[model samples]
Target: MAGAINATDASKRYAVVTGGNKGIGFEICRQLACDGVTVILTARNEHKGTEAVEKLRGLGLSDHVLFHRVDVTDASTLSSLVHFVNTNFGRLDILVNNAGVIGLVANESALKTPEERLLNMMGAISHNYELSAECIEINYYGSKRMTEAFLPLLQQSKSPRIVYVTSGWSKLENIPNEWAKGVLNNVESPPEKLDEVVNKFLEDLKNGSSKEKEWPSRMSAYVVSKAAMNAHARITAHKYPSLQVNCVDPGYVKTDINFNTGKITANEGAQNIVRVALQPEDGPSGLFFDCNKIVAF
Candidate 1:
């Protein structure tokens, strides 16, 4: 067997954050790098990614910060991330699956008053079949893909941790569909089963029966996707006893997803995620956190 690692050795640890160009993702990368962990800040656009890294460097975080391009929706781009990490770092200690979408379009032109726009932005959203499908593809499947790709490297570390950036919307009570809630709430539920629920949600929208089927009428897809992401975090923790796989619901923060109407700042929202990602060797796994405290999934 390979020798065990010294959990206290911070210099050897490394992390990769998806969608790190802006908002919460960017803050996570900045904070992690500040803590001495070599961080790869990934973004879909190369120029934006480099700029984000440069901003970090300007703050004297140049020693361990780097940039990479990754579009969670593209398979080849994801594979490239895996290869880059493997070839450069050889192993990974933390993986933050932060890339996600709100799954709804804003009709800014239709609204007259800023209050009306802010109200619409802060409130629930309506989604279509295509929007929901893509939301699931990225928010849920994209996280899954990134996790699977980095699992080997994570296993090599003594204190491997996976943090899923979920939301309070992931709570079962928010999802009106009892069947979907039951599947996700079951701690032993597998990924295949979660996929089944998500697929059915898209099908419901296609059949024009989303309301009749009991999906959340507003932000249905986004809610379902986060719920599924939470479930996957539980499943992964169960499947990997050697690793600490946890999900965190970073409370509503002012970011692009919520159109800057949130109560907290991105840095405030990222603190909990960073906490989960840097959990100790014996930290709790298979758990969900509403920021810093462990809560039900």
Candidate 2:
């Protein structure tokens, strides 16, 4: 049996929230610390990470809060994080893969004043945009790398849990094929097969062939990435029946991802994530949740 730390005796559980410097991730760290969990709030920017730690400290949760600089796309940084956790906490109870990007390329022309456009001979860039290469590199591959790097440490815990912050935009219905959808939606399928499906989808995207006939309803890159993540979570749960692994959609929270156009507050979004993280050992695994309720993949 894995070594288990008594939450009461230890005074808190240890957790790591990625991209936790701001928005929903920040709120998640705050809520977990409030619940007496020692949280490592990770961010790519050291200054931002420090500032967030200071803010959490100001809120009187410093004792349970720590900041670590991690760029999920970078392997060395991930190794450093694993080393730090192994040295300090000895075990990780919760991991929230909340780091993500919208992938929408901004139009530089939109930033210029109308008068300036009139004065210049050059035409303004269109408001409509497309996803960037960097977006896929970070949002999709970065999340996968983080999970892979931390899985060993997570296995060291008695009640390890992974909560993937996915989105409704990534539903299987948007995948557009019976076979492809079946491959992803099959919760009982072998991990290798599921991986093959995800790889095919990514390959199609790279070949500029995906979404040509029937495009995904929402942000294409974001949706596909989240779907892959949800599928991967199911595989993890199946592979490690003792561990609780789940994915969830925070339900359109007011965050930078949508340019602050969402309906819910950051705290409300964090509630669902925190709830999943704190689930009991027998709680549901390999499930997709939306605000505590199970939702379709």
Candidate 3:
């Protein structure tokens, strides 16, 4: 336990949602708050995060919602969050890792309509080593960092939950590199081994051998990162039997990630994630969810 366990905490639940300034992330915060859980709405941009919290407060969730600035890719920010939780709430009951990037570098002016954009995104967007590396850093490693930092605080809770907002692309089958896929698909693989797999992907990408290596040609980093994230979530669930850890693909919800071309609304997508996050203590763990249904990882 990081701080003196508050007597009042026994009856109260606390949650933190990353990238909570917009889209599905923002909705997750709102829904969790509505569910009676105190929520820390976090974002890399302080102004946006503050604005989001104010909006939630305006919705009459002032007592349940607050803003915190965090950049998942930065360890300092994560440490700061850990300190804040330890000092204030004393324990963390829920953590929703929703911060992610699409890994596509597109020319906005060249992109016309959502229909055409969705159909021809691959052709219009470009992928480079830097962007690919950043995607992996934020999507995969960033989630891992948040999990690791909060594990101690989470352990203090009677019922802890960890949700990784992954994607359907995270399915191992989407990873064309059989060797990489194999490593990630093996839930028994250690975290270091998973790191090695992601590192190898980056190495191959930087060397311009990703094509020869049989990795995904389009949105390669996004797919690989989410795959790694799903694998890590499984491993984490097993490692911490006291915690409910799961990965969720909230369907293709319409948000900025896909140029708002996705089919469903952000609220619909977030409900799927919030449902998993609020699963009962006896609920199943180490599973991949496609919206409300459990699917293969």
Say which candidate scores most in lDDT.
Answer: 3
Candidate 3 residue lDDT tens string, 1-297: 112223436789999899999999999999999999989899999889998988988999888888789999999988988998888888999999999997766656676787666556565323687888899999999999999999999999999999999998778887788888888888789899899988998998887788888888777888999999888999999888889999999999999988898899999999999999999889999999999999888
Residue-wise lDDT of candidate 1 within 147-225, one digit each (tens)?
8888998998878999999988878888889999999988798678998999999998898888888988767888899
Candidates by TM-score, descending order:
3, 1, 2
Using lDDT as the measure, name the better of candidate 2 and candidate 3.
3
| Model 3 spans > 4 angstroms off | 1-8, 124-126
Query: In model 2, what is the error at residue 249, expressed in angstroms?
Result: 0.8
Of 1 and 3, which scores higher on TM-score? Answer: 3
- Let me know the TM-score candidate 1 reaches against the reference structure: 0.92
Indicate whether candidate 1 or candidate 2 has the larger TM-score: 1
For model 2, which pairs clash?
Answer: none
Decreasing lDDT order of the candidates: 3, 1, 2
- lDDT for model 1, please: 0.85
Clashes of 1: 0
Candidate 2 TM-score, C-alpha based: 0.84
**What is the lDDT for 89 in model 3?**
80
